[model samples]
Target: MSTEISPESAFPGPRRVFQKLNEKPLRDDLIFYFAIVAVASVLFMMLPLLTGETAEIDGLHLIWFLVAGTLIVLVQGLITGAVALLAVSLVEHFFLLFVDVHREFEQTMKSTVYALSPLILFSWAVLLKIPFAGLLFLAWFCLSTFFGVRIFHEKSKDRAVFVALATGVVLAFYLHRAVGI
Candidate 1:
């Protein structure tokens, strides 16, 4: 038998994750996309608690706030993530048009969502109030997106780098305005 390794059998890592995700059926990817968005939303909701934004309130009020706030943030974050995903995919597809590299919109969406794994998984560091934490995660997200675009779209390094940076800047601006960071 040939020794070729499929993406599904690759060792676990960011690269493997991206590869396997890119090859997954669209339905599976959508499920994973929502799962990641939900988890990231929960972590985002924890920010206020972790940063002591609710510390002044007493017991019952704090409990009420936590419960209500979590529900609101989760719903809001999921909606926002879905909208942003569509917008970003459209933007990236438009960008690819200029490069004469046509790809399906779903492919772009898959790349975008899978690339977000880094940010969704580890962006909680921002709540720690550590210096440059946001930037670090932003860089990670950008790098992952760069590779994803390259591998998924079969783009050259230059095109992938350009698209990744363009999208990364937009994402950074959005996060800065939304999160007040």
Candidate 2:
């Protein structure tokens, strides 16, 4: 489709997200918050990857590693968070700029909640499995529902699921590269 959303018709959620963080240095709030989360996650994930089974460590080295790992985790968390926010924001931005929302915002939020239910359920199910890593699409679908609803306001159905899946793939690929996966 042409997807020519007028500034007025474009979704409101994305506009709000952008407006909230677009102040003072442009992306300070987003970068800082997400960085902390990413760093923690990265460090935690890295622990299982370390080898030498029960290798002894000096007090200083252990401390340093902890600090360093924490930093990386924070970095990753922040980046990922920013990317997540950006994904939704971009969709909203486009919609608001090109399309019109005939429905109300509250309705959109409800649909998003429903659509995201599956992803959350799947993540909880696959959190520590022997594989099926690709199942993350379930979570992405769930998340995208939230955004889709926010932007489209219950106008579209499964479209949000696809959007979420696409967002997940993009995020995973970029993160793998950024973290040297």
Candidate 3:
């Protein structure tokens, strides 16, 4: 057997990566998870700076304001993301049980994380302040979750769509509460 790895396999496209991650065993690298959270947090922090009006502040104060704002947003985003992940995963897990998809909670959590990759990774779009930008990312998240649940849980299309909708609703609630949008 060839030991060589194909480029596509080594560095898959986004959808493939999502599929591979959901198919694999649960990742133990806390750093990877933390990095995802950190990147998302930074993007979240940038939205206000990019889109909102700021008071006229001089150099030192501006630097201090940015530093402090970043710290607070990062901390809050990390905490809120972690809690939402667990809570949503638990809810999805139980929902699967009712639908007879017999998957483990860890598997459900992995699927949820990968499904959310679109939103977390491309959140910078929101910084542009375009109308309905957030909705685009939300739709992307829902589409990813639809496929993720189908592949990871071997769910039917109807069930997958239901799970995706439920996931979106939960995530929207979290975002609404967190971002006050």
Candidate 4:
């Protein structure tokens, strides 16, 4: 794990980011996670206009679009993050009660955010008009959650796997609704 943390290096790629997430501090992952979300949200908000027919907008309209789009994306990202944190935390809290695994709320939140990387990409794909992107997103989401939960419960691999799968199952519906896919 690299101690030098920056959004670029910390989130160099999905695979690298997920791997580093297991080794890096929660604070660093939180920064990187939000940065990625912000960038993704902005790009997602721009996709329709970027991919659609060009529009005739004057300077004022263009400026307004940029400013309003940025604010909307950031606000949307914050709301989504809050919801995800609550959902993931609640799920983790519930499962932890049944299992003997010892982990903190911060750890669960960090892992959940990192696990959501694939879903973010899926949303990008949806914005880009990719075929069957929703299905792909679901697959990626399940795998990411499985491994993410597994990382925090190394003591009992069986229980970890079960909890992870359950998390995936429960989160799939919530995510599908949240992403509007």
Candidate 5:
């Protein structure tokens, strides 16, 4: 592990989780993702109830629809978040090597998870049905990654930007195509 990338120092406390994500534990990151997904699922399930939009469906059918839909979304969100985390970490690791930056694989993974925290907000934006929200979230995600890469490759801002953009764009495209955002 790099001396500068110690988890303890990188993430000293969680009061400012978004700012100090690099130091947070991987399990904590996963938990955060899961918590966000659960919250979004609840919001989605409650939308019809809150808005009284179930006029088209019968009572039993409406109940089933909301329950099943929430489960499907919850499962999909967890799967998507996990895959994206692993993929981003792997992509950043290889890209760093290509740029001759010798960062530990675990360190890169930690940074990648931290960089992806904005994705939680992205989910909320999606739940709110905001206009062009995916694009907005993508921009935030990319900016998060830019700073993350810069952190990992301290002396090479240009290389960091290159790696961050390359991998971030690929991930964004993947999400767009798979999630149909």
Candidate 6:
């Protein structure tokens, strides 16, 4: 489907247009979850800051953090709100499009990802004194990827526990660098 556009797609016929849209083969259910996540992320980022964590924006460093935060929000918001409606879309874009993580774990994965990414992305933004936004995204993506894969692929609770431990290990490395933890 990624490669082969239908014959009817070349023409602007209604059927052709639908066919063309359908050709991409991304799932509708995935799109729905994506929208939900994007909205949630944007809202969370924009919401009034209630804590020193979100409330204060200090010097040039904080300014840079806010800027990167905005970009992270925008990217996440677009993907969640504009890009596609599927959980798979989130997984695809986030996981280097490595594998389709299937529908069963879609909800859990989307929830986990949308919930985690901004905070993790903003870690660099808030901790901008620490490193580039990409490093944060990289760390968060790696942790999220492991967990997302754990959510969808692990066959048993024991495997799930190990997956979580592994995620913690990777996350601890980045966070130690970020927070001196």
The prediction achieving the highest lDDT against the true structure is: 1
* Model 2, TM vs. native: 0.42
lDDT (tens digit, per residue) of candidate 3 on 1-181:
9899999878877656656666466664234565788888887767666766676888999999889988998998788778867876787776677678877777787777766655666666665555676877777778877777787887998998898888787778777633235
TM-score of each: 0.76, 0.42, 0.70, 0.75, 0.67, 0.31
Using TM-score as the measure, name the better of candidate 2 and candidate 6.
Answer: 2
Q: Candidate 4 overall Cα lDDT vs. reference?
A: 0.68
Superposing all C-alpha atoms, what RMSD in Å does each candidate have to the true structure?
4.3, 12.8, 4.6, 6.1, 7.5, 15.1
In order, candidate lDDTs are 0.77, 0.47, 0.73, 0.68, 0.69, 0.48
- In candidate 1, stretches whose alpha carbon ends up further than 4 angstroms from where it belongs are 1-16, 51-64, 173-181
Stretches of candidate 5 off by over 4 Å are 1-19, 44-55, 124-132, 152-155, 175-181
Which candidate wins on TM-score?
1
Model 2 spans > 4 angstroms off? 1-46, 49-56, 91-99, 102-129, 139-152, 158-181
Instruction: Give the better candidate number (4 or 6) by TM-score.
Output: 4
Kindly indicate the candidate among 1 and 5 with the higher lDDT.
1
Tens-place lDDT per residue, model 4, 1-181, is: 7677888765576545456667888778777777777777787777767777546787899889878878988899867866766777678657756777577777677767767755664577765557777667766665665556666544366776666667766766666754345
The 10-residue segment of model 6 with minimum total lDDT is: 14-23
**Shift in Å, residue 37, candidate 5:** 3.1
Among all windows of 10 consecutive residues in model 2, the one with the lowest summed lDDT is 18-27
Q: After superposition, how far is residue 64 of candidate 4 from its true place, in Å?
A: 2.0
**Could you tell which candidate, 1 or 3, scores higher by TM-score?**
1
Give per-residue CA lDDT, model 1, range 53-137, as digits (tens): 7568888997898889889988997898788778877777677777677778778888877767656666677656667878877
Rank list by TM-score = 1, 4, 3, 5, 2, 6
